[model samples]
Target: MPIDRLADLADAATAPRLVVKVGSSLLVGPGGTVRGEWLDSLVRELAQARARGQEVIVVSSGAIALGAARLGLAKGGRGSLADAQAAAAVGQIALASLWAERLAAHDIPAAQLLVTLEDLEDRRRYLNAAATLARLLKAGAIPVINENDSVATAEIRFGDNDRLAARVAQAASAHAIVLLSDVDGLYDRDPKDPAAQRLARVEGVTDEVHAMATGASSSGMGSGGMTSKLQAAEIAERAGIALAIVNGTHTAPLARGLSGEGIGTLFLPRRRDGARKAWLGGRQRMHGVLVVDPGCAAALGRGGSLLATGITAVEGDFGRGDPVAVRDGDGRTLAQGLAEYTAAEIERIKGRRSEEIEALLGYAPRAAVIHRDQLVLL
Candidate 1:
């Protein structure tokens, strides 16, 4: 793809979804101040993209930096884990408020989601988070996601938001991710060296590529450097999401980069399995079983969702969002999917109409026992 065609990667007709990652250096200024003017420019670009029919999700980093500043911690200092956590606890609120205020200026509602690595590791929690993001996008609100730094221990945290942004792209089923950074893009050698050259595009994040990455961040506010950005590219590639690294220190950086102004490095996706189907197909365990009738089996074969009306029996103690096997009356597994309701809930609604679900479950009913989008055939 030519540098001039970069914008097409985010075209609504072609991609439809995008994830933009704003690092701490871009969002927060010296002494914990929010970079209001810069943020307003970025927010306008986001709003324009949204108006063009793109569903955008933002993964922002600034909580720890803001928190540390509030606590009067020295800049660039590696404080104790407790200090970092306490700082994150206080800074998260300020960070969220900044985003909310800026985005609101464009009449774009912002919803904040704080997550730790564990949230993505757990199947149920992952599904729930993904579902919430999907619903938020559908409702025309942009979700502003950040790591749950306040509670995340060193061992349980992402430490940086680059890789976290890639995971968010996967969860949100985004087509491409734009990483707004201090540097323009990847370079052949030290960017400071006169002989160094910038690479316009990266084919893949191979060993040689990893070797070129520098581990330390020049800006103390952000933990991510080129190394973490490369790791994030690798994650996005495997998930079939394109990743772009570009300089965002200037006004309208996103608009310039996406406009194909020859400003960054674009990493193409090697696959197209960036949805829940891939994860569902690769799961090693099925927590429960749903025995459906012949009619339901036929319906599933035609790509229809599993409805309570077709369920003859439910087995195991699977909770909502747990992966389960869909079986027939003779006990042959027909497919596998995440349950919309728990085993007990399905048991109570088996062979019942969709309309009768509210009466049985004592709540507003879901349309399917297992939605087709969440199901995968064996």
Candidate 2:
């Protein structure tokens, strides 16, 4: 799987989707102000990518850094996690508005999405996120994504935007993920070492690659380092996505990476089009169970939608967009789909016709309890 840089450029230029991850160092200056000019250039890069028929999704980090100085936690050793979390809460507003403003200049609508690991960890939430992100892409809007650090504890948080970006790329079915970082690419040893060497490309992230891993960075506000980027690269590789770690200091950073200019290390996936199916077939854990009649089970097996009429009983107090299991009367799992209605809502609509939905609940979000596209038959 040795990557052909020029080949990658050609392939990526025609790719339907791309996810670019912007580290905090690229977004904020040492003075703690948003790097407007840098962001403007990045926006222009995205605009050009869009013109080439590529849908661009951005995962930006800098919220906590943006808030640190403002909260008087600026002049210090890396502050506590709680302090960083507080900063993230306040900085998210600034970060979102800044992206919106920058992209607006090019008539590119930027939609902000703040997510935690839980959003992608839970099967239902992952489906819900995938659907919403897909909708935004279909509507010709660029998603400005960021990690939700405000409530994420160390045990539950992704910690770095790199891994989070990988998950976003997988969920969005992106063709490539460009990690815009301070460094140019992977090195044989610490770049500071006199004998260090930079590898232009890597085919796989093996044990040897892990041995080359470094610790947290010294230059930026981000907590992640080259080791984390490699970790993220592996995730992208497993999902059949190409990952590039390029220096964000340069103008048109993403463009250079995708154009096959050999600006960074590119990690190629082992296979194309099958990683997603294999991952999905791994039996994702679903939260709730919905017992349906035989007819409903047959319909599901045929790739039809789950309707309220087919539902006979519900178990578990789940909310809208939660993944629920579809089972038969004997309790055998039939399929799994994200719920359009909450447990209570489903309870009231069970065994009711689509026509009776509006009258019973005064309104219906959708006719089907679970859309056909979201349901996965077991």
Candidate 3:
């Protein structure tokens, strides 16, 4: 896509549902204080979008930075996982309060939504989260989302808000995702070097651009780098959500970028899947593994349902109605399905006939371990 064409798309996006992600570096100033002026400007733009009748959700990163400032841990280059977690706990409160005050100034109410990987990974949780956000939007409130860093472990972490933003875009059925970062946009090489040129628009992320992206925050306040931003863009693109990476430091960049000013790298949206299917595809995180026999694996590969007799072993502690990965005995994942039986139930009845399920479990809600309609072959 050309820069001009992307400018046109951005203008069209003004009234569409949007998910905007702001990095920690952009939200905080030197000495770790909230950049009041920057946030005020950003909020003003968001208010404008809302005035245009666009529903917007913000995925913001700055809790840890604010927490560090509040705790007087201002000059550190790095910290332990414990330190980061503690900072998040303290800062999240401050972050929400700050946003509330800012939004109030514009007569817009802001709501806080703290989510972990499990919220998106679990189907029930995912639906609940989506419902809450949808209601907030319907009630004319902007939701400010952040990772629930207080209790997140390495295994169940979003790693960065960029990925979280993409997931939110998918959850909200957003039409676009605008990522405001330090750099103006993606470049063929390091933007710091004079010779490196800006990539004003990308129809799709190519191998060369993927290779060019490297490193985390030079400011030492956030974990996300250009690489993670690119990955987030890919996720949004796959879901047919338009994306923009603009310089957050610029004055009113969000509004300017959306007005066809051509100030960022614009990623064109791909052809989309059905809304329900796209939500299901992006929301479920692999919960447990069900090792199936070779015959079952082949059947599933051919888009067949998983029967009770096909499962050899169940791993992990997932409940009935949770998403589980179906793998062969060698441990390669063949498909993902909504398990009809709990892990405990599957363990007891593995390799049994479908007719035997009622007798063995006292009740059988489903004859197959996973019905074909709920299972997606990998």
Which candidate has the highest lDDT of all?
A: 1
For every model in order, what is the number of clashing pairs? 0, 0, 1
Please provide, for model 3 over 144-260, each residue's C-alpha lDDT reduced to its tens digit, 9 standing for 90 to 100. Answer: 999998788788888889989988888787778888888888888888889988888787666777898976666667788899888787667657777888888877877666564
Better of 1 and 2 by TM-score: 1
Task: Provide the overall lDDT of each model, using Cα atoms, as 2-decimal numbers.
Answer: 0.83, 0.80, 0.80
lDDT of 2 by residue, 195-228 (tens): 9888887887887998887976766578789988
lDDT of 1: 0.83
Each prediction's TM-score against the native? 0.72, 0.71, 0.76
Error of 2 at 11 (Å): 5.7
Clashing residue pairs, candidate 1? none
lDDT of 3: 0.80
